[model samples]
Target: MKLLALVALTMCAFAANSVLNRIGVALQGMDPLDFATIRTGAGAAMLWALVGLRTAPRPVILSPKRIAGAAALATYMIGFSWAYLTLDAGLGALILFGVLQIVVFGWAVFEKGAIPLLRWCGAGVALIGLCVLLWPTGQASIPLGGATAMTVAGIAWAAYTLLGRSEADPLGATASNFLLCLPLVGAVMLWSGAGPMPFAGVLTACVAGAITSGLGYAMWYRALPSLPTTVAGIAQLSVPVIAVAAGVALLGEPLTARLIIAGGLVLGGIAISLAARR
Candidate 1:
């Protein structure tokens, strides 16, 4: 019961990040670059604080693996923020989740040198769903740039997840990655010359970072050891759905028939792909 509750809360946190980002950038007039920068900074601070509470202070070691993790984190943060500028929160989450599944599945196939038939079929269905979602329509069309950015974010997040698979201490590693990404985030902000950020936007970004992202990640890591791999994969399918629902209820985003059809395909394909492995 506790595990179920934890998983549910973690999923909500993940979904909340998408909603918060959309509100911050799309509704609150926050610059994407600035939002990303503040989010990373705030997440780093929160994670480091948690680390301090959990462990004795020690000198940090810089490793290649950590650097790679940091780079992936930076990519995901920047791309996610930029994508939300134009993409509807629900749609962006769907794209990110769908692309993430494909990337991870693709990498698994590459590593194994053989693909399962069911996996291939699942991937094909997911691809078809993506096409349907991105297809031009008279009523409303997805922005190419926003979809592309979200795709990049999804790929980067997949890489980051893969990199963390073997970590001895998930929280410590994550905190280190967030801290290491701070410099890169700052560099991007400097190059872009992000505009002034409203206080509401800043607060939203901070909540996304410290609460939804930082603490959520920590809770997920804690729960991961108790979860079956398939269960973990299946549970994540809810994040997009939750995000879409939240967007409609909280942000007053439209619920279109096209999204319903495409989302079903994308999510169903992902579920089939993961379930086939069991």
Candidate 2:
């Protein structure tokens, strides 16, 4: 029960990243690239302080895994920040998690060469639910640009997770990942010509980076070892739900019928897919 609660906390932190980015970029009018840069830098600083210089991970960049992990982390950060420019917190999470699971499970099929029929069916249902969310209903439709960016972020995040699942030291690897990406993130912000963000936005970015992103990710990596692939996949299904509820409660985002119905189908389908694993 304690461990479950801990895992749940990690999920909350993940969900909080959406809210924080929304708070910074959407509500506070920070430039998306600037927010990403601040987040990467702040997260790197926090991780360095925690792990210290002598003990920090020095993953060999020559390995295919290292290059892939680094690229995925950068893509996830950049795309995630940019996506919040138009997306509501809940809506963004729905799109992100929906894409994330599809990619992860799709990779599973390739790796194992044998996924169950039930899992495939559930994946199909979830894909349909995602379409329902994306389709232009008379009242609301997800913005194509924001959805595309978040979809990219989601795929990158899944790649990062898969590649890092077997890390010998989750904390150190997280620290290394943050530090490695900090420079590129900063460069991207500079290239965008974003200047002088509001203090509120900076504060939100710092909180997201130092707490939710840096520390929360470390916790997630540590917990990954104890969870089977199917169980971990199922556990992440809670993130969208948590983000939706938080978006409504904290951000005052609407809880529309479209979102409710689509969220249920997407999350429920993914749950079925993961739960059916042998």
Candidate 3:
């Protein structure tokens, strides 16, 4: 029961980050680069505070692995922020997850992992679904720029997750990665512009970074050990659904027919792949 509750909450937190990004970037008019900068800084501060409170080993920020992690994190933060400017929270979440699955399995193939045929078909289905979602209908399909940015974000996130496998202390290393990413993200933000940041936007960025991202990740890591490997993987498939529902309820984003069909295919495909791992 506790595990179920924990997993549910963690999924909500993960979804909330998407919603918050939409709110910050779309509604609040926060510059995407500024939001990313604030988010990275806030997440870094919160995570480092948690690590210190727990008396964890001091994080190593300059290591090659840490630098790589930071680079991936920077890419994810920037691209994710840029994507929300035009993307509905639900659609954005779905795209991010769809591409994340693609990258993960692509890497598996690259490493000569023995992937099942079913998984390959599943990946194909997911690709089809993403295409359908992005298909132009002379209507409200996501803009190409937003979709492309989200795809990049998803790829970076997959890389970050894969890199995490080598970490000795997940929490500490994550904290370090957060810290190490600040400069890179900041530089990108500067390259873009240092324009005005709204108080509300900053608040949303802080909430997303500290609460949804930092604490949420910590809770996920805590629950991950208790979960079956299959469960852990399958459980994440629920995040996009949660984000879609929340986006509709909170942000009044449309629940389009196209989105429903494509979301199902993408999620179903990933679910099929995860199930085959059993």
For this target, which candidate reaches the highest lDDT against the unseen true structure? 2
| lDDT, residue 98, candidate 2 | 73
Error of 3 at 57 (Å): 2.2
State the TM-score for model 2. 0.83
Model 3's alpha-carbon lDDT is 0.78
lDDT score, candidate 1, position 248: 72
For model 3, residues 80-143, the per-residue Cα lDDT tens digits are: 9999888766568768877776676667668787777776776676666666664445677678
TM-score of each model, in listed order: 0.82, 0.83, 0.81
Candidate 2's C-alpha lDDT? 0.79
Error of 1 at 252 (Å): 3.7
Q: Candidate 1 — what's its lDDT?
A: 0.78
Q: What range of 10 consecutive residues in model 3 has the weakest lDDT sum? A: 227-236
**lDDT per residue (tens digit) for residues 56-175 in model 2:** 455443456666666788899999999988886657777787778777777776777566677677666666666565455468877899999999999999888787679788877787
Model 2 / residue 117 / CA error / Å = 5.5
Q: Which stretches of candidate 3 lie over 4 Å from their true place?
A: 1-9, 117-137, 140-142, 218-237, 254-274
TM accuracy, model 3: 0.81
